[model samples]
Target: MRTRGSTAPHLWRPYTQMKTAMPPLEVVRTHGARLVLADGRELVDGIASWWTAVHGYNHPHIARAVAAQVETMPHVMFGGLTHAPAERLARRLADLLPGDLDHVFFTDSGSVAVEVALKMAAQLWLNRGETGRSRVLAFRGGYHGDTMGAMSVCDPEDGMHRRFGGYLPSQVFCDLPRTRADIAALDAALDRHRRELAAVIVEPLVQGAGGMRMHPPEVLATIARLARRHGLPLILDEIFTGFGRTGTMFACAQADVVPDILCLSKALTGGTMALAATIATAEVFDGFWSDDPGAALMHGPTFMANPLACAAANASLDLFAGEPRLDQARAIAACLADGLEPLRALPGIADVRTLGAIGAVQFEAPPDLTVLKARFLERGVWVRPFGDIVYLTPALTIDRGDLDHLLDAVASVLREGVPPGA
Candidate 1:
């Protein structure tokens, strides 16, 4: 019911203080690696629409699948019925993921997927008659999701969820391991809190939404090892790092570590639809396989596995199987490293880091984001900087010229020196 040239004043956006926030840009349509505005101007999408469109915007394969599915069945209740799209996607994911991550539970978004993972961890203990194991052990720089349960596991002191610390369930937190001593500290902490913990959760390699922080694969391996040693389930939140975003298909794979539970979303549908899947190992699933119906996982979302969304996800998997996405990711890493690393020498620039397709330039302090955001748009590119960093997670299929243009815009903006402010 939207009219042309309408601003849609009734619509509210996320993470914005509307009273002071500027009007958002109106996008008319999207194609491969670019967004066409209402005014017909094209801007290179620097973050792939929040890192979801891995196959790029309006991909033909995904579009065709969705269109066909809509004509047949747009949606159906998942409570009592079943569908082919969901069934196929679950089997496909079970085959794709590492180890025995063989069971798939669908949800509408990443946050709910995370919420389900936490619930599974908690209930897994309760189902086994082990009471009082309710808390989770999380990391300091990790970001899980926005739901209350997910927020509880995010970086407690320094994360965006800090204000809600008093209201959420308190979970044990430890700094990400870096050295032998740090590992010892984590080992000791695990031993100290093992009795209260139901699971150990982490964002495997890159802690997305927590300032784009990057830690080594070895650190992730050590955490997994410690969790196993403590006999606690490990939950890997791969919502931001899965589906080739971190060079390899999954960040944990870089360390050859597998988790008891894994959460996936974002590029699951190639950015065409909203969908997420929480896959668990047989061990975790078996915890609920009892004759007692009271022990069953009683949570379910209204649109747990919409047929259209599942079709899009299945089509996305087809592309991954047919394309050289990993190679493209490696190429993007090289380009990002070559372009952003030089900014480390610039004044006020604290650090520059690149992993797989993600590139970040951290400032000694956050600049005026309102001004910086407009500047990027004016330069015919789209980049949204948050916290103390301006980063890029462009589509893996972006052409070399478009990628260079995005890098040029970022470099020019930083070169001119961003004025220090919020």
Candidate 2:
């Protein structure tokens, strides 16, 4: 049997340099907002399982739903047949979302959902007999996903996928429109590239995994307006900022803007399991509706609309409907502001900002992540810092004590000071 502190040698970790990186810790169990390690020590989960477990780990509602679903039906192909869980989830999502976003395409992960959205955007034009509209206009600091179609639209020069620039197809990139000049430049670029542009994709408010960069709601509104003016479909990558992460149920709501396509995952199943959805507006869906089967969107994942995942997502939506999740997110934002904002004056800390349930403390320069991670673990918190930023996206249901503990641990580590060198 594998022992504590020793991950299986054969297993490769994501975004890790195996040779020098620290060994992965063995988490024996999780409950609420805490992780129980193999050696019996508990650590407050500062990132909420990569911002998925909004209602905390192993919530009874989601667990019970999954258990019941497993007994009745575990797996089924969504290619030809439809299941109650998937159908119900689709309806729930359509009703919950703003505008006419009434269509849902299920996928197994966030990345694949993004790929599906991109496909829909591209194919929408093709089905309309419009050629030369193959490229997408994506924001500079945006991150759609790791899949090929999604990667093509991500930030090309500075994004994590830049290493694959030689392999991936090129897409137009622009900064999020912030000022009048920026908006005008974006408008000019859209007009210049109107012939080749199929869609305009962006991360509504917060650009997660792209340095947690943020833009105001007005910026999003401006982008949406420009896309409408150009008669181009807009795609919103809300996989990270959806479900109360940015204070509203959906980040697009803050701007009163609805996209033609919206990708969602992460916290869709309350972080209990993998499930994702790519929803489209009525206008986008109409492009694929025809007598010719060739007009159909031809991509489908084998595990599309897995019954178990759908059940979990349905239960997660129930929690959102029944519980005060939006209120919880607001509370978290206030708490984060109170706890982390003071650290801005600390040496080495460049900026501190909070939105809804998210908080970030960016350093002037990249600190020694390995040393900082060790210090956080020693202080009994699971805080992962990457590339000059130490951010928090804890579970919305995390109790004040644990939340305070997480903030305190981060403060203690900063007080000790980050070691020089990356």
Candidate 3:
């Protein structure tokens, strides 16, 4: 393996190109939706640090809970042994999740949670003696994560896994139901491959990383009905849409549809620590409930259900209940949407989409992100532009003043162009 210094600049970058020259801003500290840069600049966080940090950075409740758990027991292998925190968190999640998704399988991140869900779906088919139903189906412009199985279900046009062409598993993709034609195309595809389909995975209501495209709840309900009609399981990847991001506790709640299996992450631990869970119904769990060990769901990470993460999750649920975070998120989303209405009338704007606390403004052409990003930064607002689409996904705890500042920055950029050095 090459040394760290010898690696290419782009190899370890989180997202986008690192080799392409861009100005760097260092954040040294953060608290309650504000970030303090190492250069003594403070700015409001618009994207919530990649759409996590729901309760904002360094939340006292989360910090205290995590610290207490660490002091008691930092970690333990979850394969066989059990812990109180994990059990409590699982029970809380079961109570909060929409339907009978009672079982929880924890993993390190959203990517691994997706991998677990896909494996469970395939194994469920196998246990039901439907070996022919091995192929997985996902929608175009959907992004799950970066793991191999997750990559297989994601849209190849996303350009994340182009280099690993042969490494990915064979899967089917259907167009997102943006129009009648799109829905018809999906039904046709299902008719063509229903016998071979194992599951249909979707990022309900809104597609996050795929430029924040929003679709109606009716489209999701249609897909759920089709899945049931075809005897195929449905998996909802609500890692980004969960926890009040979609104006409801879960986007599926709004549609009155429930998936056989659901993937949750992102704000699961109140953005305090990395934690993800794949909750499934008893029927799905029954597939692995056999005396024969080989029939078991033989997949789990070493750090599954770590106590510290579990404690943080439990505390997060408490905060949600005490503060009514979902209601707060709804109000904030409406405010942001109203504030952004003027952008729709702007010259270069292509579309403005909003769902709950997430709003996006896509331009006809890719703006000079370098300049636009700098302008926002200079204005004490930290908003990220995904290519041509500038989006806001602030924490639920964001103050009204900070939210107004964020909107003002966008307004300034639209009117005067990017500021100097931006």
Clashing pairs in 1: none
Give the poorly placed runs of model 2, Cα more than 4 Å off: 1-6
How close is every model to the real structure, measured as TM-score? 0.98, 0.98, 0.94
User: Which candidate number has the best lDDT?
Assistant: 1
What are the per-residue Cα lDDT tens digits for candidate 2 across 1-422?
Answer: 33324458777788887677678989999999999999999999999999999999999999999999999999998888999999999999999899999999999888999888878988988898988888889989788888898898888988889999989977888889999889989999999999999899999889889888888999999999999999999999899999989999999999999899999999898998888999999999999999999999998899889999999999999999999999999999999999999999999988997889999999999899989999999999999888889999999999999999999999989988998764
lDDT for residue 346 in candidate 1, whole number 0-100: 94
Where is model 1 more than 4 Å wrong at Cα? 1-6
Q: Model 3, which residues run further than 4 Å from truth?
A: 1-11, 418-422
lDDT by candidate, in order shown: 0.94, 0.91, 0.86
Q: What is the lDDT of residue 8 in candidate 1?
A: 76
Candidate 3 local lDDT, 1-422, one digit each (tens) = 33233334334556645446453566789999999998898999998887788888888888999999999999999977999999998898888887789999999899999999999998888887778877788988888999999988887766457577688888889887768898788888888998788899999999888779889999899889878877788999999999888788899998999899999989989887799999999889988899888888998799999899999988888888888788878988888789888888888788888889998988888788777887787789998886578899999889899899998888878777532222
Better of 1 and 3 by TM-score: 1
TM-score of 2: 0.98
lDDT accuracy of residue 328 in candidate 3: 75
